[model samples]
Target: MDALEILFTASFWVAAIRIASPLIFATMGELICERAGVLNLGIEGIMTAGAFAGWFTVYAGGDLWTGVLVAALAGAMFGLLHATLTVPLGLSQHVVGIGVTLLATSLTYFIYRLALPEVTSPPKIEPFQPLPIPGLSKVPVLGEALFSQTPLTYLAFLTVAVVAWVLYRTPVGLAVRAAGENPSAVEAQGISVTAIRMGAVMVGSALMAVGGAFLTMSAFNSFFFEMINGRGWICIALVVFGSWRPGKALIGAILFAAFDAYQVRLQQMSGGIVPYQVFLMMPYALSILALILVARRATYPKALMIPYQKGER
Candidate 1:
Protein backbone atom coordinates (compact mmCIF):
# COMPACT_ATOMS: atom_id res chain seq x y z
CA MET A 1 0.00 0.00 0.00
CA ASP A 2 1.01 3.62 -0.57
CA ALA A 3 2.06 5.94 2.25
CA LEU A 4 -1.09 8.03 2.35
CA GLU A 5 -3.41 5.03 2.22
CA ILE A 6 -1.75 3.39 5.19
CA LEU A 7 -3.13 5.90 7.68
CA PHE A 8 -6.69 4.65 7.24
CA THR A 9 -5.95 0.98 7.77
CA ALA A 10 -7.15 -0.77 10.91
CA SER A 11 -3.93 -2.70 11.13
CA PHE A 12 -1.88 0.50 11.12
CA TRP A 13 -3.91 2.01 13.93
CA VAL A 14 -3.78 -1.18 15.94
CA ALA A 15 -0.01 -1.06 15.75
CA ALA A 16 0.04 2.61 16.71
CA ILE A 17 -2.16 2.13 19.75
CA ARG A 18 -0.19 -0.89 20.81
CA ILE A 19 3.02 1.11 20.54
CA ALA A 20 1.48 3.99 22.51
CA SER A 21 0.46 2.00 25.57
CA PRO A 22 3.79 2.12 27.39
CA LEU A 23 4.37 5.77 26.59
CA ILE A 24 1.01 6.63 28.07
CA PHE A 25 2.02 5.01 31.37
CA ALA A 26 5.47 6.58 31.59
CA THR A 27 4.36 10.02 30.48
CA MET A 28 1.69 10.09 33.14
CA GLY A 29 4.31 9.10 35.70
CA GLU A 30 6.61 11.95 34.71
CA LEU A 31 3.67 14.34 34.66
CA ILE A 32 2.83 13.51 38.24
CA CYS A 33 6.42 14.05 39.43
CA GLU A 34 6.72 17.38 37.63
CA ARG A 35 3.30 18.48 38.82
CA ALA A 36 4.51 17.98 42.36
CA GLY A 37 7.68 20.03 41.62
CA VAL A 38 10.09 17.12 41.15
CA LEU A 39 12.02 16.49 37.98
CA ASN A 40 12.80 12.76 37.91
CA LEU A 41 15.76 12.13 35.67
CA GLY A 42 15.97 8.59 36.98
CA ILE A 43 13.11 7.51 34.71
CA GLU A 44 15.40 5.79 32.20
CA GLY A 45 17.11 3.68 34.84
CA ILE A 46 13.87 3.14 36.68
CA MET A 47 12.25 1.81 33.52
CA THR A 48 15.23 -0.45 32.84
CA ALA A 49 15.10 -1.87 36.33
CA GLY A 50 11.37 -2.36 35.99
CA ALA A 51 11.69 -4.10 32.64
CA PHE A 52 14.10 -6.61 34.14
CA ALA A 53 12.20 -6.90 37.40
CA GLY A 54 8.92 -7.75 35.71
CA TRP A 55 10.43 -10.07 33.15
CA PHE A 56 12.55 -11.80 35.72
CA THR A 57 9.58 -12.33 38.00
CA VAL A 58 7.59 -13.97 35.26
CA TYR A 59 10.64 -15.91 34.14
CA ALA A 60 11.03 -17.20 37.66
CA GLY A 61 7.47 -18.65 37.53
CA GLY A 62 5.36 -15.84 38.96
CA ASP A 63 2.15 -14.66 37.29
CA LEU A 64 2.13 -11.65 34.99
CA TRP A 65 0.26 -9.45 37.47
CA THR A 66 2.73 -10.37 40.16
CA GLY A 67 5.54 -9.32 37.89
CA VAL A 68 3.86 -5.98 37.39
CA LEU A 69 3.45 -5.49 41.14
CA VAL A 70 7.10 -6.34 41.76
CA ALA A 71 8.12 -3.82 39.12
CA ALA A 72 5.99 -1.13 40.76
CA LEU A 73 7.47 -1.84 44.13
CA ALA A 74 10.98 -1.65 42.74
CA GLY A 75 10.26 1.73 41.17
CA ALA A 76 8.70 3.06 44.36
CA MET A 77 11.81 2.20 46.32
CA PHE A 78 14.01 4.13 43.95
CA GLY A 79 11.56 7.03 44.03
CA LEU A 80 11.77 7.06 47.80
CA LEU A 81 15.53 7.25 47.64
CA HIS A 82 15.30 10.11 45.16
CA ALA A 83 12.68 11.97 47.19
CA THR A 84 14.64 11.62 50.41
CA LEU A 85 17.78 13.06 48.88
CA THR A 86 16.18 15.82 46.85
CA VAL A 87 13.10 16.89 48.78
CA PRO A 88 14.23 16.67 52.38
CA LEU A 89 17.97 17.22 52.14
CA GLY A 90 17.67 19.84 49.40
CA LEU A 91 20.22 18.38 47.00
CA SER A 92 20.61 19.24 43.35
CA GLN A 93 17.81 17.55 41.45
CA HIS A 94 19.83 17.06 38.30
CA VAL A 95 22.75 15.29 39.92
CA VAL A 96 20.65 13.10 42.14
CA GLY A 97 18.37 12.09 39.29
CA ILE A 98 21.21 11.10 37.03
CA GLY A 99 22.82 9.22 39.87
CA VAL A 100 19.62 7.32 40.50
CA THR A 101 19.43 6.32 36.86
CA LEU A 102 23.00 5.07 36.80
CA LEU A 103 22.55 3.20 40.02
CA ALA A 104 19.32 1.53 39.03
CA THR A 105 20.60 0.50 35.61
CA SER A 106 23.80 -0.94 36.98
CA LEU A 107 22.05 -2.74 39.79
CA THR A 108 19.54 -4.28 37.41
CA TYR A 109 22.27 -5.46 35.08
CA PHE A 110 24.22 -6.95 37.94
CA ILE A 111 21.18 -8.83 39.15
CA TYR A 112 20.48 -10.19 35.71
CA ARG A 113 24.02 -11.47 35.32
CA LEU A 114 24.01 -13.00 38.78
CA ALA A 115 20.73 -14.76 38.17
CA LEU A 116 21.43 -16.03 34.65
CA PRO A 117 25.09 -16.81 35.20
CA GLU A 118 25.67 -18.75 31.99
CA VAL A 119 22.59 -18.19 29.83
CA THR A 120 23.17 -16.68 26.42
CA SER A 121 19.63 -16.36 25.18
CA PRO A 122 16.98 -14.62 27.27
CA PRO A 123 14.10 -16.80 28.44
CA LYS A 124 10.55 -16.16 27.29
CA ILE A 125 7.21 -15.97 29.03
CA GLU A 126 3.57 -16.23 27.94
CA PRO A 127 2.61 -12.59 27.60
CA PHE A 128 -0.80 -11.02 27.84
CA GLN A 129 -3.16 -11.44 24.88
CA PRO A 130 -5.58 -8.97 23.34
CA LEU A 131 -9.20 -9.03 24.45
CA PRO A 132 -11.78 -7.47 22.20
CA ILE A 133 -14.74 -5.70 23.69
CA PRO A 134 -17.78 -7.64 22.49
CA GLY A 135 -19.74 -4.86 20.81
CA LEU A 136 -17.10 -2.17 20.34
CA SER A 137 -14.58 -4.38 18.55
CA LYS A 138 -17.07 -4.62 15.68
CA VAL A 139 -17.07 -0.89 14.91
CA PRO A 140 -14.36 -0.70 12.27
CA VAL A 141 -10.85 0.72 12.64
CA LEU A 142 -11.38 2.65 15.87
CA GLY A 143 -12.93 -0.29 17.64
CA GLU A 144 -10.23 -2.74 16.71
CA ALA A 145 -7.58 -0.19 17.55
CA LEU A 146 -9.02 0.95 20.86
CA PHE A 147 -11.19 -1.83 22.20
CA SER A 148 -9.09 -4.81 21.21
CA GLN A 149 -5.85 -4.67 23.14
CA THR A 150 -4.15 -6.56 25.96
CA PRO A 151 -5.29 -5.79 29.49
CA LEU A 152 -2.15 -3.71 30.09
CA THR A 153 -3.01 -1.43 27.20
CA TYR A 154 -6.46 -0.90 28.63
CA LEU A 155 -4.87 -0.13 31.99
CA ALA A 156 -2.56 2.40 30.37
CA PHE A 157 -5.51 4.35 28.96
CA LEU A 158 -7.35 4.07 32.25
CA THR A 159 -4.27 5.45 34.01
CA VAL A 160 -4.49 8.60 31.90
CA ALA A 161 -8.11 9.14 32.88
CA VAL A 162 -7.36 8.45 36.53
CA VAL A 163 -4.43 10.85 36.51
CA ALA A 164 -6.53 13.57 34.93
CA TRP A 165 -9.27 13.11 37.49
CA VAL A 166 -6.86 13.10 40.41
CA LEU A 167 -5.04 16.14 39.15
CA TYR A 168 -8.08 18.25 38.36
CA ARG A 169 -10.90 17.02 40.56
CA THR A 170 -9.53 15.94 43.90
CA PRO A 171 -8.37 17.73 47.06
CA VAL A 172 -5.14 15.71 47.02
CA GLY A 173 -4.64 16.97 43.48
CA LEU A 174 -4.93 20.54 44.68
CA ALA A 175 -2.15 20.04 47.18
CA VAL A 176 0.11 18.39 44.65
CA ARG A 177 -0.42 21.25 42.23
CA ALA A 178 0.18 23.76 44.92
CA ALA A 179 3.38 22.00 45.92
CA GLY A 180 4.70 22.60 42.46
CA GLU A 181 3.33 26.10 41.95
CA ASN A 182 3.92 27.41 45.44
CA PRO A 183 4.99 25.12 48.22
CA SER A 184 4.77 27.91 50.74
CA ALA A 185 1.11 28.30 49.91
CA VAL A 186 0.63 24.59 50.40
CA GLU A 187 2.44 24.86 53.73
CA ALA A 188 0.20 27.78 54.69
CA GLN A 189 -2.79 25.53 54.17
CA GLY A 190 -1.44 23.11 56.77
CA ILE A 191 -0.37 20.50 54.25
CA SER A 192 3.11 18.99 54.53
CA VAL A 193 4.77 19.87 51.25
CA THR A 194 7.44 17.26 51.90
CA ALA A 195 4.93 14.48 52.23
CA ILE A 196 3.00 15.59 49.14
CA ARG A 197 6.06 15.95 46.91
CA MET A 198 7.64 12.72 48.14
CA GLY A 199 4.40 10.82 47.77
CA ALA A 200 3.96 12.11 44.23
CA VAL A 201 7.49 11.08 43.27
CA MET A 202 7.08 7.58 44.69
CA VAL A 203 3.75 7.09 42.95
CA GLY A 204 5.07 8.59 39.74
CA SER A 205 8.09 6.32 39.81
CA ALA A 206 5.84 3.32 40.36
CA LEU A 207 3.92 4.18 37.21
CA MET A 208 7.15 4.58 35.31
CA ALA A 209 8.19 1.11 36.43
CA VAL A 210 4.87 -0.26 35.28
CA GLY A 211 5.49 1.31 31.90
CA GLY A 212 8.75 -0.62 31.74
CA ALA A 213 6.95 -3.76 32.83
CA PHE A 214 4.59 -3.26 29.89
CA LEU A 215 7.54 -3.66 27.57
CA THR A 216 8.61 -7.14 28.74
CA MET A 217 5.14 -8.30 29.74
CA SER A 218 2.97 -7.08 26.88
CA ALA A 219 4.92 -5.65 23.93
CA PHE A 220 7.24 -8.63 23.82
CA ASN A 221 7.48 -12.05 25.42
CA SER A 222 11.15 -11.89 26.27
CA PHE A 223 13.61 -9.48 27.81
CA PHE A 224 16.81 -8.11 26.31
CA PHE A 225 19.26 -5.35 27.04
CA GLU A 226 18.22 -1.87 25.92
CA MET A 227 14.74 -3.02 24.97
CA ILE A 228 13.41 0.15 26.50
CA ASN A 229 15.53 1.97 23.89
CA GLY A 230 15.24 5.45 25.37
CA ARG A 231 11.48 5.29 25.64
CA GLY A 232 11.77 6.76 29.10
CA TRP A 233 13.54 9.82 27.75
CA ILE A 234 10.89 10.15 25.05
CA CYS A 235 8.28 9.98 27.76
CA ILE A 236 9.96 12.90 29.53
CA ALA A 237 9.74 14.88 26.34
CA LEU A 238 6.11 13.82 25.89
CA VAL A 239 5.29 15.20 29.34
CA VAL A 240 6.54 18.59 28.22
CA PHE A 241 4.88 18.25 24.85
CA GLY A 242 1.55 17.79 26.58
CA SER A 243 2.30 20.65 28.98
CA TRP A 244 2.03 18.13 31.82
CA ARG A 245 -1.62 17.34 31.24
CA PRO A 246 -2.62 13.68 31.12
CA GLY A 247 -5.10 14.04 28.25
CA LYS A 248 -2.78 16.04 26.03
CA ALA A 249 0.10 13.69 26.85
CA LEU A 250 -2.09 10.78 25.78
CA ILE A 251 -2.66 12.47 22.42
CA GLY A 252 1.06 13.19 22.08
CA ALA A 253 1.90 9.55 22.82
CA ILE A 254 -0.54 8.37 20.17
CA LEU A 255 0.78 10.86 17.66
CA PHE A 256 4.36 9.73 18.22
CA ALA A 257 3.28 6.10 18.11
CA ALA A 258 1.51 6.69 14.80
CA PHE A 259 4.66 8.25 13.40
CA ASP A 260 6.59 5.20 14.57
CA ALA A 261 4.09 2.75 13.12
CA TYR A 262 3.99 4.68 9.85
CA GLN A 263 7.75 4.74 9.57
CA VAL A 264 8.03 0.96 9.75
CA ARG A 265 5.48 0.54 6.99
CA LEU A 266 7.25 3.17 4.94
CA GLN A 267 10.45 1.22 5.32
CA GLN A 268 8.73 -1.87 3.97
CA MET A 269 7.33 0.07 1.04
CA SER A 270 10.71 1.64 0.30
CA GLY A 271 12.07 -1.80 -0.57
CA GLY A 272 15.60 -0.72 0.51
CA ILE A 273 15.50 2.33 -1.77
CA VAL A 274 15.56 4.59 1.27
CA PRO A 275 18.07 4.22 4.06
CA TYR A 276 16.67 2.39 7.09
CA GLN A 277 18.20 4.96 9.44
CA VAL A 278 15.97 7.69 8.01
CA PHE A 279 12.89 5.68 8.71
CA LEU A 280 14.10 4.89 12.19
CA MET A 281 14.66 8.58 12.89
CA MET A 282 11.33 9.76 11.52
CA PRO A 283 9.36 9.42 14.75
CA TYR A 284 11.92 11.22 16.86
CA ALA A 285 12.39 14.04 14.34
CA LEU A 286 8.65 14.54 14.06
CA SER A 287 8.28 14.42 17.81
CA ILE A 288 10.99 17.07 18.22
CA LEU A 289 9.27 19.36 15.75
CA ALA A 290 5.96 18.82 17.52
CA LEU A 291 7.57 19.46 20.91
CA ILE A 292 9.05 22.76 19.74
CA LEU A 293 5.70 24.00 18.52
CA VAL A 294 3.79 23.01 21.64
CA ALA A 295 6.37 23.59 24.37
CA ARG A 296 6.79 27.29 23.64
CA ARG A 297 3.26 27.92 24.79
CA ALA A 298 3.41 25.26 27.49
CA THR A 299 3.07 26.53 31.02
CA TYR A 300 5.33 24.52 33.31
CA PRO A 301 4.93 24.31 37.01
CA LYS A 302 6.72 27.27 38.62
CA ALA A 303 8.62 25.21 41.14
CA LEU A 304 9.67 22.21 39.03
CA MET A 305 13.17 20.96 39.96
CA ILE A 306 13.35 23.36 42.84
CA PRO A 307 13.89 21.48 46.08
CA TYR A 308 11.30 22.23 48.74
CA GLN A 309 11.98 22.32 52.45
CA LYS A 310 9.32 22.37 55.15
CA GLY A 311 9.84 25.94 56.29
CA GLU A 312 11.94 29.06 55.57
CA ARG A 313 9.52 30.52 53.07
Candidate 2:
Protein backbone atom coordinates (compact mmCIF):
# COMPACT_ATOMS: atom_id res chain seq x y z
CA MET A 1 0.00 0.00 0.00
CA ASP A 2 1.09 3.55 -0.63
CA ALA A 3 1.73 5.91 2.29
CA LEU A 4 -1.57 7.77 1.96
CA GLU A 5 -3.56 4.62 1.29
CA ILE A 6 -2.26 3.01 4.44
CA LEU A 7 -3.84 5.69 6.56
CA PHE A 8 -7.28 4.58 5.44
CA THR A 9 -6.74 0.94 6.21
CA ALA A 10 -8.32 -0.81 9.18
CA SER A 11 -5.27 -2.92 9.84
CA PHE A 12 -3.08 0.17 10.09
CA TRP A 13 -5.27 1.67 12.76
CA VAL A 14 -5.54 -1.64 14.60
CA ALA A 15 -1.79 -1.75 14.83
CA ALA A 16 -1.64 1.89 15.87
CA ILE A 17 -4.13 1.39 18.68
CA ARG A 18 -2.33 -1.70 19.88
CA ILE A 19 0.97 0.16 19.83
CA ALA A 20 -0.59 3.06 21.69
CA SER A 21 -2.08 0.94 24.51
CA PRO A 22 0.98 0.65 26.74
CA LEU A 23 1.93 4.24 26.02
CA ILE A 24 -1.47 5.49 27.11
CA PHE A 25 -1.04 3.75 30.44
CA ALA A 26 2.42 5.15 31.08
CA THR A 27 1.55 8.65 29.91
CA MET A 28 -1.42 8.73 32.26
CA GLY A 29 0.86 7.59 35.03
CA GLU A 30 3.34 10.40 34.35
CA LEU A 31 0.49 12.88 34.07
CA ILE A 32 -0.73 11.91 37.53
CA CYS A 33 2.71 12.44 39.05
CA GLU A 34 3.27 15.76 37.32
CA ARG A 35 -0.22 16.92 38.18
CA ALA A 36 0.56 16.32 41.83
CA GLY A 37 3.99 18.01 41.55
CA VAL A 38 6.53 15.23 41.20
CA LEU A 39 8.84 14.32 38.34
CA ASN A 40 9.25 10.57 38.00
CA LEU A 41 12.30 9.91 35.86
CA GLY A 42 12.25 6.39 37.23
CA ILE A 43 9.56 5.36 34.77
CA GLU A 44 11.95 3.51 32.44
CA GLY A 45 13.23 1.26 35.19
CA ILE A 46 9.81 0.93 36.77
CA MET A 47 8.45 -0.29 33.45
CA THR A 48 11.35 -2.70 33.11
CA ALA A 49 10.73 -4.01 36.60
CA GLY A 50 7.01 -4.29 35.99
CA ALA A 51 7.57 -6.13 32.72
CA PHE A 52 9.65 -8.71 34.51
CA ALA A 53 7.50 -8.88 37.63
CA GLY A 54 4.24 -9.44 35.77
CA TRP A 55 5.63 -11.97 33.34
CA PHE A 56 7.54 -13.82 36.04
CA THR A 57 4.48 -14.05 38.22
CA VAL A 58 2.49 -15.69 35.47
CA TYR A 59 5.42 -17.88 34.49
CA ALA A 60 5.60 -19.06 38.10
CA GLY A 61 1.92 -20.17 38.05
CA GLY A 62 -0.02 -17.05 38.95
CA ASP A 63 -3.04 -15.92 36.93
CA LEU A 64 -2.81 -13.06 34.42
CA TRP A 65 -4.66 -10.48 36.47
CA THR A 66 -2.69 -11.49 39.53
CA GLY A 67 0.48 -10.91 37.57
CA VAL A 68 -0.70 -7.42 36.76
CA LEU A 69 -1.41 -6.78 40.45
CA VAL A 70 2.04 -7.98 41.47
CA ALA A 71 3.57 -5.65 38.93
CA ALA A 72 1.62 -2.70 40.33
CA LEU A 73 2.68 -3.57 43.86
CA ALA A 74 6.28 -3.79 42.73
CA GLY A 75 6.00 -0.41 41.07
CA ALA A 76 4.36 1.08 44.17
CA MET A 77 7.24 -0.08 46.32
CA PHE A 78 9.72 1.72 44.09
CA GLY A 79 7.44 4.73 43.97
CA LEU A 80 7.35 4.74 47.77
CA LEU A 81 11.13 4.83 47.89
CA HIS A 82 11.16 7.72 45.42
CA ALA A 83 8.54 9.63 47.38
CA THR A 84 10.25 9.11 50.72
CA LEU A 85 13.46 10.56 49.40
CA THR A 86 12.05 13.40 47.34
CA VAL A 87 8.91 14.40 49.22
CA PRO A 88 9.98 14.22 52.86
CA LEU A 89 13.76 14.48 52.55
CA GLY A 90 13.55 17.17 49.89
CA LEU A 91 16.31 15.64 47.83
CA SER A 92 17.00 16.61 44.24
CA GLN A 93 14.12 15.12 42.31
CA HIS A 94 16.38 14.60 39.28
CA VAL A 95 19.06 12.77 41.16
CA VAL A 96 16.65 10.66 43.16
CA GLY A 97 14.58 9.83 40.15
CA ILE A 98 17.61 8.65 38.21
CA GLY A 99 18.79 6.74 41.26
CA VAL A 100 15.43 5.00 41.57
CA THR A 101 15.61 4.06 37.92
CA LEU A 102 19.06 2.52 38.28
CA LEU A 103 18.16 0.74 41.50
CA ALA A 104 14.92 -0.72 40.13
CA THR A 105 16.49 -1.77 36.87
CA SER A 106 19.46 -3.45 38.51
CA LEU A 107 17.32 -5.17 41.12
CA THR A 108 14.95 -6.48 38.49
CA TYR A 109 17.78 -7.92 36.43
CA PHE A 110 19.22 -9.61 39.51
CA ILE A 111 15.87 -11.16 40.36
CA TYR A 112 15.45 -12.33 36.81
CA ARG A 113 18.88 -14.00 36.78
CA LEU A 114 18.29 -15.62 40.14
CA ALA A 115 14.83 -16.87 39.20
CA LEU A 116 15.66 -18.29 35.81
CA PRO A 117 19.17 -19.52 36.70
CA GLU A 118 19.60 -22.02 33.87
CA VAL A 119 17.02 -21.05 31.32
CA THR A 120 18.48 -20.01 27.99
CA SER A 121 15.23 -18.59 26.66
CA PRO A 122 12.75 -16.42 28.47
CA PRO A 123 9.70 -18.31 29.72
CA LYS A 124 6.34 -17.67 28.22
CA ILE A 125 2.83 -17.17 29.64
CA GLU A 126 -0.71 -17.26 28.36
CA PRO A 127 -1.37 -13.59 27.77
CA PHE A 128 -4.73 -11.84 27.63
CA GLN A 129 -6.75 -12.28 24.43
CA PRO A 130 -8.75 -9.75 22.52
CA LEU A 131 -12.45 -9.49 23.32
CA PRO A 132 -14.36 -7.66 20.67
CA ILE A 133 -17.42 -5.77 21.78
CA PRO A 134 -20.61 -7.23 20.31
CA GLY A 135 -22.03 -4.28 18.39
CA LEU A 136 -19.16 -1.86 18.39
CA SER A 137 -16.53 -4.09 16.88
CA LYS A 138 -18.45 -4.10 13.64
CA VAL A 139 -18.35 -0.36 13.04
CA PRO A 140 -15.75 -0.13 10.26
CA VAL A 141 -12.16 0.90 11.04
CA LEU A 142 -13.05 2.62 14.28
CA GLY A 143 -14.65 -0.49 15.72
CA GLU A 144 -11.79 -2.82 14.99
CA ALA A 145 -9.32 -0.23 16.15
CA LEU A 146 -10.99 0.73 19.41
CA PHE A 147 -13.37 -2.01 20.57
CA SER A 148 -11.55 -5.15 19.52
CA GLN A 149 -8.60 -5.09 21.87
CA THR A 150 -7.50 -6.93 24.98
CA PRO A 151 -9.20 -5.99 28.24
CA LEU A 152 -6.08 -4.06 29.29
CA THR A 153 -6.40 -1.71 26.34
CA TYR A 154 -9.96 -0.99 27.34
CA LEU A 155 -8.72 -0.39 30.86
CA ALA A 156 -6.14 2.05 29.49
CA PHE A 157 -8.95 4.08 27.90
CA LEU A 158 -10.99 3.81 31.08
CA THR A 159 -7.99 5.09 33.04
CA VAL A 160 -7.92 8.27 30.99
CA ALA A 161 -11.59 8.88 31.66
CA VAL A 162 -11.18 8.12 35.34
CA VAL A 163 -8.12 10.36 35.59
CA ALA A 164 -9.91 13.24 33.91
CA TRP A 165 -12.84 12.79 36.24
CA VAL A 166 -10.71 12.63 39.34
CA LEU A 167 -8.54 15.56 38.32
CA TYR A 168 -11.37 17.88 37.37
CA ARG A 169 -14.61 16.58 38.84
CA THR A 170 -13.72 15.32 42.31
CA PRO A 171 -12.64 16.93 45.55
CA VAL A 172 -9.66 14.62 46.02
CA GLY A 173 -8.53 15.68 42.55
CA LEU A 174 -8.66 19.29 43.65
CA ALA A 175 -6.43 18.54 46.61
CA VAL A 176 -3.97 16.76 44.37
CA ARG A 177 -3.86 19.64 41.92
CA ALA A 178 -3.65 22.15 44.73
CA ALA A 179 -0.70 20.30 46.19
CA GLY A 180 1.13 20.80 42.93
CA GLU A 181 0.04 24.33 42.24
CA ASN A 182 -0.03 25.94 45.68
CA PRO A 183 1.06 23.77 48.56
CA SER A 184 0.79 26.69 50.96
CA ALA A 185 -2.85 27.08 50.01
CA VAL A 186 -3.34 23.36 50.39
CA GLU A 187 -1.71 23.65 53.81
CA ALA A 188 -4.12 26.45 54.65
CA GLN A 189 -6.92 24.07 53.76
CA GLY A 190 -5.44 21.66 56.35
CA ILE A 191 -4.31 19.16 53.74
CA SER A 192 -1.01 17.37 53.75
CA VAL A 193 0.99 18.12 50.61
CA THR A 194 3.43 15.38 51.49
CA ALA A 195 0.69 12.81 51.64
CA ILE A 196 -0.87 13.96 48.39
CA ARG A 197 2.39 14.05 46.42
CA MET A 198 3.49 10.71 47.75
CA GLY A 199 0.12 9.18 47.06
CA ALA A 200 0.13 10.54 43.53
CA VAL A 201 3.56 9.14 42.84
CA MET A 202 2.61 5.72 44.14
CA VAL A 203 -0.63 5.55 42.18
CA GLY A 204 1.07 6.92 39.09
CA SER A 205 3.81 4.35 39.38
CA ALA A 206 1.25 1.61 39.76
CA LEU A 207 -0.30 2.61 36.47
CA MET A 208 3.14 2.79 34.85
CA ALA A 209 3.77 -0.76 36.01
CA VAL A 210 0.49 -1.86 34.51
CA GLY A 211 1.64 -0.28 31.27
CA GLY A 212 4.76 -2.43 31.42
CA ALA A 213 2.67 -5.48 32.23
CA PHE A 214 0.76 -4.81 29.07
CA LEU A 215 3.94 -5.29 27.07
CA THR A 216 4.41 -8.76 28.48
CA MET A 217 0.84 -9.91 29.07
CA SER A 218 -0.93 -8.51 26.05
CA ALA A 219 1.41 -7.23 23.29
CA PHE A 220 3.72 -10.20 23.67
CA ASN A 221 3.57 -13.40 25.73
CA SER A 222 7.14 -13.42 27.00
CA PHE A 223 9.36 -11.04 28.92
CA PHE A 224 12.68 -10.02 27.45
CA PHE A 225 15.34 -7.49 28.33
CA GLU A 226 15.01 -4.07 26.66
CA MET A 227 11.48 -4.97 25.62
CA ILE A 228 10.17 -1.67 26.96
CA ASN A 229 12.67 0.03 24.60
CA GLY A 230 12.41 3.61 25.84
CA ARG A 231 8.62 3.59 25.72
CA GLY A 232 8.60 4.94 29.27
CA TRP A 233 10.65 7.97 28.29
CA ILE A 234 8.36 8.49 25.34
CA CYS A 235 5.50 8.53 27.82
CA ILE A 236 7.15 11.36 29.71
CA ALA A 237 7.25 13.42 26.56
CA LEU A 238 3.68 12.44 25.83
CA VAL A 239 2.62 13.94 29.16
CA VAL A 240 4.15 17.22 28.04
CA PHE A 241 2.64 16.83 24.59
CA GLY A 242 -0.78 16.50 26.18
CA SER A 243 -0.21 19.46 28.44
CA TRP A 244 -0.60 17.17 31.48
CA ARG A 245 -4.17 16.33 30.57
CA PRO A 246 -5.39 12.75 30.24
CA GLY A 247 -7.43 13.14 27.08
CA LYS A 248 -4.74 15.10 25.31
CA ALA A 249 -2.15 12.60 26.43
CA LEU A 250 -4.27 9.83 25.01
CA ILE A 251 -4.25 11.61 21.70
CA GLY A 252 -0.51 12.10 21.86
CA ALA A 253 -0.04 8.39 22.48
CA ILE A 254 -2.20 7.50 19.50
CA LEU A 255 -0.52 10.03 17.30
CA PHE A 256 2.89 8.70 18.17
CA ALA A 257 1.65 5.16 17.71
CA ALA A 258 0.30 6.06 14.31
CA PHE A 259 3.67 7.44 13.37
CA ASP A 260 5.22 4.19 14.55
CA ALA A 261 2.76 2.03 12.68
CA TYR A 262 3.18 4.13 9.59
CA GLN A 263 6.92 3.82 9.74
CA VAL A 264 6.82 0.04 9.73
CA ARG A 265 4.54 0.05 6.75
CA LEU A 266 6.73 2.59 4.99
CA GLN A 267 9.71 0.35 5.58
CA GLN A 268 7.91 -2.50 3.89
CA MET A 269 6.94 -0.35 0.98
CA SER A 270 10.51 0.84 0.57
CA GLY A 271 11.77 -2.75 0.41
CA GLY A 272 15.56 -2.41 0.16
CA ILE A 273 15.59 1.07 -1.28
CA VAL A 274 16.00 3.18 1.87
CA PRO A 275 18.05 2.77 5.04
CA TYR A 276 16.03 1.21 7.88
CA GLN A 277 17.30 3.58 10.58
CA VAL A 278 15.51 6.52 8.96
CA PHE A 279 12.19 4.72 9.20
CA LEU A 280 12.90 3.67 12.79
CA MET A 281 13.41 7.28 13.83
CA MET A 282 10.18 8.53 12.27
CA PRO A 283 7.90 8.23 15.29
CA TYR A 284 10.22 9.91 17.74
CA ALA A 285 11.03 12.70 15.34
CA LEU A 286 7.37 13.36 14.76
CA SER A 287 6.63 13.20 18.46
CA ILE A 288 9.37 15.73 19.20
CA LEU A 289 7.92 18.04 16.63
CA ALA A 290 4.50 17.63 18.17
CA LEU A 291 5.84 18.24 21.68
CA ILE A 292 7.54 21.42 20.57
CA LEU A 293 4.27 22.68 19.20
CA VAL A 294 2.20 21.82 22.25
CA ALA A 295 4.65 22.67 25.03
CA ARG A 296 4.86 26.30 24.01
CA ARG A 297 1.32 26.95 25.18
CA ALA A 298 1.32 24.39 27.96
CA THR A 299 0.84 25.97 31.36
CA TYR A 300 2.54 23.63 33.76
CA PRO A 301 1.66 23.36 37.42
CA LYS A 302 3.36 26.08 39.50
CA ALA A 303 5.05 23.75 41.94
CA LEU A 304 5.90 20.87 39.62
CA MET A 305 9.17 19.28 40.65
CA ILE A 306 9.44 21.76 43.54
CA PRO A 307 9.89 20.14 46.92
CA TYR A 308 7.00 21.07 49.14
CA GLN A 309 7.57 21.26 52.88
CA LYS A 310 4.59 21.70 55.13
CA GLY A 311 4.50 24.96 57.21
CA GLU A 312 7.63 26.26 55.46
CA ARG A 313 5.98 28.06 52.53
Q: Per-residue error at 273 for model 2, in Å?
A: 1.8
Which pairs clash in the backbone of model 2?
none
Query: Least accurate stretch of 10 residues (summed lDDT) in model 1?
Result: 282-291
TM-score of each: 0.98, 0.98
Q: Count clashing residue pairs per candidate.
A: 0, 0
| Superposition error at 180 for model 1 (Å) | 0.6
How high a TM-score does candidate 1 get? 0.98
Off by over 4 Å in 1: none
Tens digit per residue, CA lDDT, model 1, 160-264:
999999999999999999999999999999999999999999999999999999999999988788888888888988999998889989999998999899989
How much is 153 displaced in model 2, in angstroms?
Answer: 0.4
lDDT of 2: 0.91
Query: Which stretches in model 2 have alpha-carbon errors above 4 Å?
Result: none
Return the top candidate by lDDT: 1
> Could you give candidate 2's per-residue lDDT for residues 119-229 as a string of tens digits?
899978899999999999999999989999999999999999999999999988999999889989988988888999999999999899999999999999998888888
